[model samples]
Target: MHITVEFGGGAELLFDNKKSHDVTLPEKDKEWIIKDLLIWIKDNLLKERPELFLQDESVRPGILVLINDADWELMDTVNYVIQENDRILFISTLHGG
Candidate 1:
């Protein structure tokens, strides 16, 4: 199954490579999703920019995740059921001093 992941302040990434239909995700990745939504952020957002992983946080400062035009926060975050052709968007959250 192919899914499109959009990165906040970044570009859209496509993951067409699937090893299995019932592939269980890593425990660490699962935890990250619940706590800070890192897994979804990393999997979707960081493709060309591998340097982002080196940082302490999995989700960058400005990153905001949206699954199928709805914010992940409103949905199930990482546990959200990713269906075929589901559109995931990432955008930067505006912060003013």
Candidate 2:
């Protein structure tokens, strides 16, 4: 299955273009979702700060993950059932100046 991954803060990427795309759950793509997401996050955001993931925190300080506009904490998390066109937004939490 194919899903459009849209990062918050104006980032966008597409995946699974080798087969017919649909909204249903693709067994083959399940594991890839979590692994791919971590890879994306690590590569895109923490490339310069590889120690981010090493910290002991639940939600982290500067990262926010939203699935289709809703917080991932409210969803199934990494196991959340994803669909075609589902938007994944990774936002950086902002603090007061």
Clashes of each: 0, 0
lDDT string for model 2 (34-87, tens) is: 445555445444424444332342334565778778888797666665665676
* Weakest lDDT window of 10 consecutive positions for candidate 1: 14-23
TM-score of 2: 0.50
Task: Compare the candidates by lDDT and give the number of the best one.
Answer: 2
| Tens digits of per-residue lDDT for model 1, 1-97 | 3455444443332123221122233344232233343454456434455443324543454557677788777876656666545666656554334
TM-score of 1: 0.46
**Model 2 clashing residue pairs (backbone):** none
What are the runs in model 2 whose C-alpha is more than 4 Å off?
Answer: 9-36, 40-47, 53-61, 94-96
Please give the CA lDDT of all the candidate structures: 0.47, 0.49
